[model samples]
Target: MELDGQRKSDNVEDVRGRSGSGFGQGNFGRRGIRFPSGGGGRGLSLSTIIILALIYFGLRAMGIDVAQLLDDGSSGSSSYQQQSNASGAEQEMKVFVQRVLASTEDVWTDIFEAHGGQYDMPKLSLYSGQYPSACGTASSATGPFYCPGDRKVYLDTAFFTELSRRFKASGDFAQAYVIAHEVGHHVQNLTGVLPKFNQMRQTMTPAQANKMSVRVELQADCFAGIWGRKADDKGLLSAGDLQEALNAAQQIGDDALQKRAQGYVVPESFNHGTSAQRMKWFKRGFDQARMEACDTFSDPV
Candidate 1:
């Protein structure tokens, strides 16, 4: 991608190196936090408190800060303006992220205006290790996600390294597609699609919810393709850019991930669509460049 003279977004918050806030120490799932249970109650029992203290001390002895895990984000230097001595590569990555975010802001704003609506831009939060979000605590293990509660996209840049090394989806455009997909979720939140899905999922069975989630995720993929279309029109995309994004969609499909992790696959547990479906929807959006063309919910996806 050629971004030499492109604008960079000021809506990015770099919270890397700052102590993260939230309770418990566990990886976050795709879009939700996996908090350890301590039994259901308004207050902890004496035994429970003692057990927790013991665990905390044990972790501390192992050089972990249990207090940081429970930080409410109130007693630290403000993460908003914290300085960092980031390496050259990391600094370049940050600049790339800001430029991609700016592209999304411009593309979405124009698309919304064309439909007689104003786009409400969402902020992007950059953090390493873990960070507090209105929806939950975001960890690197969670990957990149958009929190509807805070209307912001959370990302850990280290995931880009994993994307290249583990997933073999190495390219600047592939990385941009990841950012664009999360931004697509922010668009869904603004359009009421996400809110409705969240409400309906509350009453849905696990299988049913997973089915709906596939459609939601696929739609976001399509939206990312739409952004790709706009970027191409602006001469931002290079020769292999589109292929890079398509390959990324293929690599990160739910079925592919499941197959790699385990020897077998469970069809019912697939929440993000298969490789073919992801590529198809993304291509559809790229070719059509219209929001109506990306509707995965209306038809049999």
Candidate 2:
């Protein structure tokens, strides 16, 4: 992918070294954050406040400055300093993420406008090690995920290294596909798909929910392919770029991951689709470049 002259997104939050693990430290439970009132407009319960305080002090005892993790009302606009210990390659990876995110913003905005709707851009947070998100604590082990609660994508760039070394899916486009897939979840949030699924899953059995989850993940994969189509149209994709993304989809498929980790496949627990399903949906979106073609829920995925 040639992103040399592309615009970088301003919606990026560089909270790499400023975050730590603790309950109520992210967008979900930041300092001065407010939750929905209960009963007669009551605030937090006493137990909740005590739990937060205990967690705060415990984190401090471990040499973590909890204040840095709290939202300071200057998140999107704040000028964040890059970690002094960051390597040159890591810096380049950050730039690559910004460019890829910017591309998604551009593509989605145009698509939404064409459909007579306004696109609400989602923020991307870059963190190292462990960082708090509205969804939960995001760590390297969690890879990259989009939090519908905050409409932000949380990413640990180290996952890109792991993608190459462990998954053997390496390339600029593969990394871009990872970012785009999470952003696709942000798109689902805007379209009411994510919220509906979240609500419906509350009443669904574990197996049923896993089935629904596979559809959700495949739609996101298709959405990423749509972005890849747009990027390719703009001459951003180079030779073997599409193959890189397809390989990534295959490598991270539920079947492939399960086979790699354990040695057997359990179809009942499959939530992200098999390698063929992922590749097929992605290719469908890439070939069609239409939102209708990516409807994994209504169509046979």
Candidate 3:
């Protein structure tokens, strides 16, 4: 990961040391709860959803407006404070994130142009604690996510520490892979894949919808690998960069995560793929470096 001279993306919104929107006003809501809509929301993060679902189940008996909490009425899109006093390693990571985002802009812009499409660079927001996004309130507990409703990627800088320390997938490239994967979801939104999936999921059984979700998330992993391929081609990646990202993909797989959290694997409950499946899809995109190779839906399940 050699990004010494790279240009930083101007699209980054650094809200690290600021108060959240008025939504942060003394509310009953806790920050970063992973609640998904019935038919049209990003799949919840594995561990977060399980924990939140347990709490949600207990609260449902009390007649809480779960729907309002899940959707949050879409505040549309907004950027909070721009000033960040982050210093030391955290500040370095921020600059690195900006550069990686700039790289994605360059790579996707070229790819989109070649395919006769215009690419709109997605906004990236750096936050600490909780921030109100178009999707809902983003908390540090929910990890990094892309909100298709806002066309923005939200990240808590603390997640980088957790990614390396808890997940044991440390490296600059691993962080880039995380950002690229979320941006991949933005690509899905741009190409209308997410809306179509959401529409179809309305008629699907829970298991069926979960399977579709695996495809969606796996495809995003592949898209991250596509960005890795571009970085490799441009001689930006060091020798260990690819393995860092691969290790990250394996670590965050739903199967691996569930096993770690609950000591068992439940395939039916998986929204993201298994460890091998995630690594395989990422490799597919890395090896082929094309969008066609990244199609998880049509591929044999």
What is each predicted model's overall lDDT from 0 to 1?
Answer: 0.90, 0.90, 0.88
Tens-place lDDT digits, model 2, residues 17-80? 6546444544432346655543566777777778888999999999998778775645543333
Q: List the residue pairs that clash in candidate 2.
A: none
lDDT (Cα, tens digit) per residue for candidate 1, span 174-274:
99999999999999999999999999999999999999999999999999999999999999999999999999999999889988899778999999899
Clashing residue pairs in all predictions, respectively, total 0, 0, 0
- Stretches of candidate 1 exceeding 4 Å from the true structure: 22-86
Candidate 1 local Cα displacement, residue 134, angstroms:
0.8
Ranking by lDDT: 1, 2, 3
- For residue 148, model 3's alpha carbon misses the true position, in angstroms, by 1.0
The local lDDT score (0 to 100) that residue 198 gets in candidate 2 is 97
What TM-score would every model get versus the actual structure?
Answer: 0.79, 0.79, 0.78
**Model 1 lowest lDDT segment of ten:** 27-36
